[model samples]
Target: MKKLQLSLLLMVFLVMAGCSQSETTNTEVNKLKETNKTLIEDYNKLVDKKEKLEMELDTYKEVDENSKHLTTIIDDFIHAAQKGDTATMQANISKEFTFEKQEEWLTAVNGEKNFPFYSDFYKTKLKSWYLQGIDYDKEKDFVRVFARVGYSDGEDSWYFEIIKEDGYFKISDLQYET
Candidate 1:
């Protein structure tokens, strides 16, 4: 009877040990699955962020290119203004621009009167000038380019409003800060 009781106790101990080991393995597997799910979620979020960054980078590149082209256009206009070439200046001006505005430019160029963005006035007054920046208005579908201009007395802010016409950009108006 002692030997039978001992055998029964040994078998019960073995069975309990096996059941606990199996439970531990199941718990480890569940934890691993949860960790894998979290890793997948984190990876997806990174991918989304990477895509958004790429799009923003592309937009900046396009803006840079546009700025370069616009600078060229404005440079040509400034050169024409320095020489008092109305035809070349008119070429850069938008067709939609008013004849009255054209007269203002003509008069300003001839030194008959003062208007903002007169390169001749700039010729006499400005020590140095450069484009500050460009902004696009989506609502109006127009662009404004700011210029950093410093004349003999003081620095002033100037801007040229640009618009697309006939699939090309043209200057429509000029302004100066008070």
Candidate 2:
């Protein structure tokens, strides 16, 4: 009887040890799952942040691409006008170019109206155009330029706009502002 009781006690102890080990394993598995979940969440947040940063960078590039160099176009306009080269002017004007007649266009450059006001203005003979400025509007698909022309009298600023065509640039508009 004594031996039988000892055997029974040993069996109970062994069962208890087995149960404890099983519980420990379950706890460890739960911990690993929780760690994996947290890591996944962190990775998702980082991806979102990276996407936002990329968008902001793209915005900056668009603004830069469309926003500089009015002078170059203006120079083109002056040269075209002085040489009376309609082809050269067309090269810088929008295809659907709109303004009054050429006279009205010239008047604007002279700042005869809403155009800016500057004293000592003179028309360039347009022997050769030199770029003075360039400006663009990214959203509008248009660009403006400023140029110096060699007029019979002297040099002056001429502004013109280029229209976007078939993923290319063309002269479609012209104006002169002081």
lDDT of 2 by residue, 1-178 (tens): 9999999999999999999999999999999999999999999999999997797667556535754433444455555555454566556554554323343343222224333222223343345556666665556656666565554656556665666566545655555533
Q: How many residue pairs in model 2 have overlapping backbones?
A: 26
lDDT of each: 0.71, 0.58
Instruction: State in Å the error of residue 94, model 2.
Output: 1.9
Local accuracy of candidate 1 as per-residue lDDT tens digits, 1-178: 9999999999999999999999999999999999999999999999999997797666556656788888877777766654566677778877654222353344333234244334333345446678888987545667788986666677767688888779887887776674
Looking at model 2, residue 84 earns an lDDT score of 51
* Candidate 2 weakest lDDT stretch, 10 residues: 110-119
Local lDDT at 112 for model 1:
43
What's the distance in Å from true for residue 5, model 2? 32
What's the CA RMSD for each of the models?
Answer: 7.2, 7.6
Worst 10 residues of 1 by lDDT: 107-116
Question: lDDT value for candidate 1?
Answer: 0.71
